[model samples]
Target: MSKIRKKKIKKTNILLGFICILLAVLLGFILVTSYKSEQKESRHLSEIADDQQSGIEDYEAVKERAKELEEISSEEAEDTEDTKDTEKTDTADTEDADKTEDTKDKTTAASGIVCWGDDLINGEESNTYSYMTVLQKLLTDNGYNMTVINKTLQGGGTLSMMKMAGVSDETIQSYITKHQQAANGAQLNVTETGIRDLTEEQTTRNDMDCIPVIFMGYYGGWNHDPAELADQQEQILNTFQNKNQFIVVGTRPMDGSVTSEALDQVLSQKWGEHYISLADVTAQPSSTYEAQQAMAEAILQKLQELNYISKN
Candidate 1:
């Protein structure tokens, strides 16, 4: 009887130890699975956070862009008024006006540089007010008869818009590459979709055929691929045939989005002598008008070097 009892007790002890071991193994497996699941969830949450941050940045950009557009519109209204006044004066003073018109016609018939750009170069807001005025001053001062046609204060700078307006794919591609490389091998954040808009809008203008050179510049709010940009540059060069006659001047990430690389590369290629760093423009940190004058001086110097002025 004693032996039987001892054997039963031993059996019970063995059974309990086996049960404990099984439970421990099951518990470890559950813990590991739970830990893995938690890790996956954490990673997913991190991605969501990153996307949210990007969305916020894009939202801010859009808002800023809207503000810029409103300002530009007001300035444009003022310009229209000024233009109307000038037209009235010209009509009243026909003799003098005719002489001026004739001279301008003659100059156009002779030779001149046609300049153009997107909002960064032609915005209506105070922050962007001086681009054209500065450019015009530079051209006139340097003796080049210049005609500027500003298009698309809001939606005129994308590649798709350019294609719709008749700018060649080759031209668009060339512009992108040139801009990216000009920005110094830095990955241009501009997307391919909007790349051709500015070109198309510019080409569609009635004045497009008249301008010899296209001046294109932009700031932030878009992503332009560097590889695509280089290809576009090559295409433009091939299409234009005459660099001296149909030169394309471009400044990338014009809204302070791009580093100096884009500007540096562009200047090094076509308008190296003509290139002026934004620093030069804002040397004294003066009013928008004063800074524009400074920019004008640099551009004027380039025009002079180009021999646009008559010797008369």
Candidate 2:
């Protein structure tokens, strides 16, 4: 072919590629814009449906659809809140849960509470509320500006939790391999409806420093060993590197022998006011929805006493 013809072909190809690139960029912009708009509209509708906002009298169909969407979202959050929360009711049943992977980083964002623990914290899968779920609602309803992060492992025990924190020995670390998904199906749950993103203000507040809530359930075997359990509890607590940035929650003791007397004593004594035991909060620390609400209430009370948060 002539050099002129060759030059023309090359130019045609170059122009076509540029057009294709332009088209791709335009398409991507359109998709992202649409997604963002939909999200905004959805949020508006949800605010109305949830009765958090008003003045939509002319948009009855939109209101109805929003209600349906809100209901669906509520159901999804309820159904999968298990992050095998399938059996938080019985300790024996907890062994069936399978979890892998770690939470990735313990150096957290300071805009919220980081809750870590086992089934009791995870709550039962069928139930609508884990303590984190209840806590999120409580904070929002009571006019607090903190997010609640649920990092509970459904069947995770003391050793498993230690591994998640990367505080335990290599033996235990190799044993669990990776941590489980959270009880609420998402690693970070800010709402009962599912995981929600943090606001820019919430995320950037005070340099992303987060308050850690430490709550670990016992291992399945011979969970009645308080002294040994106390030592394990101590190990996990020390890993936070800053005692002042976290709160420790003692689970309902295992038959009052395994946890209450020995476990709670060790934690409370060492951590002093930084610790709160469910034993003091409730004689029954069952994982029912109501019980979870009670747990959230107790946590809020403790936060008030600590002055970690205050009503706005």
Candidate 3:
């Protein structure tokens, strides 16, 4: 009876020990599974944080690039504006210069003939009445209105006769007879008028008003002494001054027979470069068409330099 009881108790103890071992094994498995799940969750949280950080960096970089682009656009706009302003300023300056030139030309034209000279060159021969005719042609070619007064007198080159207020009886008789013959008695009742009876001032004024007046005459040569040439120049200047007109004097060349260095010297001293000698003025054949063309060209050049035309 004692052996059986002892055997049963031993078996019971062993069974209880086996049960405790099984429970311990189950608890260990549960703890390991829970630990692994928690580790996975932590890793996921770390990955999410890293992604957020990358996104923030990208956003900041984009903002910086946008600011840079804005600055570039603003600078481009300013450059465009500056370019336009410069162009406008240049245009204004050009216009101002053109206006100034126009004003100067108008003033000169309104002042009448400020300067005049004889033949542009020395040692030149010209028809007395045709001198102004050539000048008129030249002026007209150069876009100026030019008409010449036709006057017939004994000395075509001298202004003395034209300036004189008195005429001889013989000259008056000759004029009347010539007119009577030209009429051929067709107008027998035609009245005979004496030159002395004519109004000098009124006739002179009428002649001056009839055509374009040019102060051109032959002087300063063997025909006239230095004193005479100087006197003539002075007289013409004085006369034209009173009338407010331009005068032209013809000078003899130093190389010509009547070459008086004195006249040139005086002219150079008093007139500066305004005087022109017949030699230079009529170097080309005086009677030739080519000479006429050359003379016209020279005069046109002078007018252009004096700002007579619109500036290019």
Q: What TM-score would each prediction reach against the true structure?
A: 0.41, 0.47, 0.37
Model 1 agreement with the true structure over 113-156: per-residue lDDT tens digits: 44433443234553345555666655665555565444334423
Off by over 4 Å in 2: 1-109, 121-127, 171-208, 220-224, 252-259, 310-312
Ranking by lDDT: 2, 1, 3
Instruction: Give the candidate order by descending TM-score.
Output: 2, 1, 3
Flag regions of model 1 displaced more than 4 Å.
1-111, 121-129, 137-146, 151-165, 169-191, 195-214, 220-242, 246-257, 261-263, 266-271, 274-276, 279-291
lDDT of 3: 0.48
Instruction: Give the residue spans of candidate 3 off by over 4 A.
Output: 1-129, 150-154, 157-203, 206-223, 241-247, 253-257, 260-262, 284-300, 303-312
Provide the global lDDT of candidate 2 against the true structure. 0.61
301 Cα displacement, candidate 1 (Å): 1.7
Candidate closest to the true structure, highest lDDT: 2
Per-residue error at 50 for model 2, in Å?
Answer: 99
- Give the backbone clash total of model 2: 12
Clashes of each: 28, 12, 17
lDDT (10s digit) by residue, model 3, range 249-278:
344533343453555666556544334443
lDDT of each: 0.53, 0.61, 0.48
RMSD of 3: 20.5
